[model samples]
Target: MLKLNKIFIFTGCLLVILSIELLLAQKQTKTYRNYHFVYDTADSVYVKKLAAKIKKQLHQIEFFFNYKPKSIITIIITRSDAEYTSYRGKIMPEWSQALALTREKIILLKIENADDIIRSPEILLHELVHIFFDDRITTHKIPVWLHEGIAQYLSGYELTVNDRIHLANALTSNNIISLTAMDSLFTFGQVKARLAYIEALTAIQFIVKNHGVAALQMLINN
Candidate 1:
């Protein structure tokens, strides 16, 4: 029975790999300016509609950073949750909707439904910020709070009133997490993670409010 179970597991894994390969083979490519989008053939119409918006957002980001990436940015938009999880032979966190592979100049987005498709531009802008910021500085490792904070800020993630309430409540209750602990917050439960994001955004907001935009660029430089 143990041997049979092992066989079953192996076969399942093999099938998953084959399925992903088939999906990749069936992917359609669409190029818009510096961006190259790779998505399932069925998503072609959606991707085509999204490309112009993505281009506009990319230009805004480039202007904000005053830097343009020389290499093409490859974006892979996965059509379903299963394909999204199975691609690259690695499973991402369930809460993660998108990711930026900084060095590889690639962004992977999971589009599970119409809402996700509508939100794709915002998601893409966030990941693009990550890539662009990483491209600016090569030597030092950016702190998680600062990294996430900057990305959120540049991508125009506004803090809701509830977010402010949650943050204030945490602060008053002495449940506030340290900046050092922010790195591990992503692996924690959703409630904590949400708080962490709020904290990070607030931190960046404070910095920008007091120090000015030049301070952010200086921080990126050194």
Candidate 2:
């Protein structure tokens, strides 16, 4: 009888523990956040103004892709100088912030300010461009330039003054890179590190402006 009682106690304890584990698992699943998409209260007015501009810029790009105008976007807007410096790299405004993650999802950090030229609509569209062709970026043996360039082009952000200055220097000095070379140097500090960002943006601009958005979409579909 004592032995039987011990077995019952042990079984009860096991069941209780299992129940707790199940509850925790359910909570985690419920709380699994995807991306942070919200605006800063301080930048509300600026955000609205830029949003309109961005919408105008993206009109053509969206038409080309057949994307609904109301597509959802996820991004994190940073307000603090420390936050901006940390995320954007300890260098210059030419960077503003960076993009990290796969297509179908994107993480935009604080390099571009709410009051800056990034334009709200443009940022979202830029990230979508990354997501749109994310799969091709995976299989097409496409390089980083294609990834960044496409995003920059479709999004229609005029290069910031700082960015253009850097670009000018790089181009005049014959320091520009081709698609193949950009692939190798993208994540690495190939030629002044951030130079890859400019090259990618310029190249994408060239493709879309000359060949049309269909050329880019075909590459992704292929």
Candidates' C-alpha lDDT: 0.80, 0.56
- Tell me how candidate 2 scores on lDDT: 0.56
Task: Judge candidate 1 at residue 176 and give its lDDT.
Answer: 94
Error of 1 at 77 (Å): 0.9
**lDDT score of model 1?**
0.80
Encode model 2's per-residue lDDT on 1-222: one tens digit a residue.
979966765664455334333433322111112333444566566545545555555566556566542333445445555654433342233434445344224344453443544455666667756665653345565566776677777777677889888989878989776667765553455346567778777776777789977787786657
Off by over 4 Å in 1: 1-22, 88-91
**Best candidate according to lDDT:** 1
